[model samples]
Target: MPVLVNSHPSPPLHIDMTPPKPIIAVVTGTGAQGRAVSRAFHDTGKWHVRVLTRNPAGKVAQAFQKEGMEIVKANFEDKASLVKAFEGAYAVYSNTVPPWHQSYTNKLGEYEQGVLQADAAKQCNVQLILFGTLPYVGPEFMGLGGVELYDAKARTNDYITSLGLPAVYISMPAFIDNVHSWPLVKAIDGGAKLEFVGYVVKPDKPMVFLWVERDLGPSVLAIAESFRTFGRPLAEHPLNHNVLPVGSWRGTWGQVSDEIEKQTGIPTIHNVLPSVDQRWHRELTKVFHYQNTHGLFPTDNFPTKVFSSLGVQYGTVEEFVRTKIAPMFRKS
Candidate 1:
């Protein structure tokens, strides 16, 4: 009974107050990759997402803003804007669109943007950086050339490592989402009977494919969280400077087409390309040849364990076609 007199329970101590979530700066946040990353982290309710985009007034930016994300205006070519956007960001996801598609720039421009983003991240003292990149499948591999896209990104990867910044290289594979863009899908949409186009590679040759919005975003979110939780102090983390080859499923193109037919209930036929003379066709042929000769990953490793630890389960190719691809035909 010594001090048993009413002490108001210490005012119920506010020790349970939630800590503020880390702020992650997503470069090109309105794009496919950036949007996926932002949505994944935002869904977790454990991160404050700040997206960097040149067009904050665009539809995608407005949509994101309505979802409670912070959008900042920045351009890849403008290092100062990037620095300002990156200021106080706990981490950054860096990506550059292949300039070949942008109509004004070339591969060199893409590489420059990557370097500028890395430099800006460095200046802003971002704790971690994840690069969306591909393997440097160049002539050095087997006298196979024409893959300037991959080579430019590989050079950027090298530059990022040279900066001595904490980084993770996430090598994205061919996207399953591209199936919609393929002539096969267009033919189906136009009421033509389905016909599968086979490439120069063998039917049994394995290809890696990812459902970008489904697989990529979650994988990136896991990597970012893992770096924060386990990758601090650099040397203690296994992922530091690690190259993670990511994809949803690995299958021969034939197998993928078969799955598509099965899921879509469309009869299909497979035929090799009539010609490979066009620059685009020639470049793609080189890619298929390289993949057939060498493998997509550096080692046979697939990072399954890492993805598992992060609780990410990739959807099967059939599942993707059923849920994502088949619907397009119905819409048309």
Candidate 2:
């Protein structure tokens, strides 16, 4: 009686019992980069995500747990713990941070920790390792001595490569998130109206601002896939084996100010700091100077084809200011 004319007998069910997806261990999984990289790998549902944190009971760790990530407690200073956590992983996303509690940036400690991470990855025999390192700003460059915050990670980049491990160094552009800082944005006390938006860079120096939370993850996915498939981007690449500098929107802080003002109808300015007296201010100004003096990130070979071929869409500085930063009128 049923209308079964179009349907013959159903085929038998088949469940292929293949091995599970590869595991990617995210060391320092609670930081911003950690959250981005881990989420990128996790969202693909193609990899078994293992996030290493010092506190498994912490809120961030718990959130990772809810997302089906394997949370393994790890302390970078403790090499044995890292080794145990890193074992049996296909790849490792190594992001080492200096303990801000100790003078903002600990150069020696970060370098040592990076070596430890590299050592662990080597011991585990991982297929790939990704290090979130900054461009090496050594004392020889501009004689600003060297920004330890950047140099520490740069030192680690060299350390990772020295081991001959399969690795990709990821140099992130300046974070657009700095728009939220007190010096950058101003608003009528507790009100929604913007007063002023500002930054420290010289008005016209073109810098790359990345919406890391949204873009970094996918870029990581793209890079990892390329490395996994053909050991590098199938598309011709210009960068050396050590660093793959990913680029996004290209503009200056002055242009950024104009964009914010255009979106919010507020006055904006490049309020360059009068003096780099404060310790943090001095260090940060050096970073801006580094970008100003010797250019920041180059975009010519950003794996655009790989990104498009893989159906990846990236965010722009304008969109970021309009959607996330603009909501913040939300910024001053």
| Candidate with best lDDT | 1
On a 0 to 1 TM-score scale, where does candidate 1 land against the true structure?
A: 0.84
Whole-model lDDT per candidate: 0.77, 0.74
Flag regions of model 2 displaced more than 4 Å: 1-16, 101-108, 181-183, 189-200, 231-240, 274-281, 298-312, 330-332
Which RMSD values do the candidates have, in order? Answer: 5.4, 6.7
Worst 10 residues of 1 by lDDT: 99-108
Estimate, for each residue in 119-207, the C-alpha lDDT of model 2 and write its tens digit.
98989888788888888888877888997768988888888878877788888778876575434666654554444443356768777
Residue-level lDDT for 127 in candidate 2 = 74
Weakest lDDT window of 10 consecutive positions for candidate 2 = 232-241
* Residue 218 displacement in candidate 1 (angstroms): 1.0
